[model samples]
Target: MENRPQPFHITLVRHGESVGNAEARWQGQADYPLTDTGRAQARALAERWKNENAKFDLLISSPLIRTKETSEIIAATLNVTVEFDPLWLERDNGDFSGLTAHEVRQNFTHPQFSTPYDPVGGDGEGDWELFLRAGQALQSLLKREPARYLIVSHGGLLNQFMHAVIGVAPQANNSGTRFRFGNTAFAQLMYYPHQHRWAIDRINDHAHWKDTD
Candidate 1:
């Protein structure tokens, strides 16, 4: 029998509720701090992971205030340091950044027909661009030695990351599948690089706060 290398373990977590989320604003790389409720959610998630004895060799997060706070809370509870990466930042929305939904309707015109390569908000990365960025991020992670990795990021980027993992192509005109990542929710995945395989263990797992919902 031959020894097999340990599979790469990855946990993808979305930041807790932000003011933008609460206000229905386009957050798209716009910096926003976590609300008090968001902090509480992070604490709850931290407690859940602590109770489960979850361990990770590396914890990376987007440097945005919302993700930074969420990662800090969990890292503190887990006794792990966090490394910030811009690659994990939320999708850049260009002129739509920080704008509310109602404002967007009033300020910008929506095209009835658009392609995946169409820039968002007139200048930001389109679906294809974001997908490519997500691939780059995954590649960077795979370049490192196999180990457990925890990533704290935004929903949009995380969605694209999952798409990359499952080899889902971006669809035109926002018709692609979307992964739901509520506040403090997370997905667990495993990759056997030697076998060139990936497994999605769970998605949108927020059992820690199930009772509250």
Candidate 2:
């Protein structure tokens, strides 16, 4: 019998709530520690995985404080060490970093018309740039041997990664599709490198803490 190519099992997770999240800040690349609720969410996720007997061969995370804290909690529960990568970092929001919605409106003037190529926050990454970065991150992951990978990252990057997986280009002026990744929410995916095929098993999974804040 011919040997079948091993499929890569990837779980993309958004970090739990942070101080910035509580403050409703943009938080793009701005380091903010997880809030108390955020830590509770992480624990809940860890408990859920432990109960499910979930196993991951590799654990990767963004170095941001929020993501690092969330990943550390899960890693402790799963007995996996986390490898941090800047590529997994959140999209740089430039001038908008650590700003709230009202503050952003007060500070930056909104362009009447903008394209995906237009820089965000007057200097931050454009949609296409983030998409390209996501593609690069995906490619790097594929270079490793097929295994179960748990990635703790930000919502913006994860959304771009999903777009890359589905071959969707960035839309102009934020009119593109969006994936909602709540605190401690995750997306499970499978990739067959030999056949260049991908499967999305789940998206925005946070059943463990649906009842709680």
Candidate 3:
């Protein structure tokens, strides 16, 4: 058997926590600024990349303020410009936009009205559909760039992207092969063009946050 060629190399980073995160509210499509702790987390991640001599050929992020802020922090240390991409935006929660988790569960009784558990409602794209589009957009972008890159996005989008790359569903406590992205965390992915698949190199790596409180 011949060795298969690897796909493009990419890194996934989740945006730092935001006010909505602290308040346990669904911020889908709602813009929220990063909290003080979130800023610290972003700084810690940036420092980690600098200390480890990490290099990125390109830096991309969701257009959302939180993701843009987080990407800027990392890009500063890398001395690279950041690109804001709408495709990288987080899931659109639609009607669930500003509702708390409890409120969503209480008000929406549909089978798919749960958090990280069920699909969201309203005029939003289905989770599966969003994943498909995001994966396609990423693949197209990788083909154009074809370089080591860093992407700062939301947790929901990250999870879906991981699933698209690894050909699996995103679940809690999955094994190392599974794709899991934490707040201000990162994962390494290599695309295998021969197999037309994206292999997971690492997931939910938070070594950058070691010194953070």
Could you give candidate 3's per-residue lDDT for residues 1-213 as a string of tens digits? 976554577888888888888888898768998988888899998887888898888888899988988888888877977888888888888798878899988987665234333455666756666777678756667666457788898887777777776576444322224355667888888876666766777878888675322
lDDT value, candidate 3, whole model = 0.77
Candidate structures ordered by lDDT, highest first: 2, 1, 3
lDDT of 2 at 145: 96
- For every model shown, what is its TM-score relative to the native structure? 0.97, 0.98, 0.84
Better of 1 and 3 by TM-score: 1
Per-residue lDDT of 1-213 in model 2, one digit per residue for the tens? 999989999999999999999999999999999999999999999999999999999899999999999999999998997999999999999999999989999988998888889888889998999999999999999999999999999999999999999999998778979998998999999999899999999999999989433
What are the lDDT scores of the predictions, listed in order?
Answer: 0.92, 0.94, 0.77
Candidate 2 structure lDDT: 0.94
- The superposed Cα distance between candidate 1 and the true structure at residue 210, in angstroms, equals 2.7
Order the candidate numbers by TM-score, best to worst.
Answer: 2, 1, 3
Better of 2 and 3 by TM-score: 2
lDDT of 1 at 28: 96
Specify the poorest-scoring 10-residue window by lDDT in model 2: 204-213
TM-score of 3: 0.84
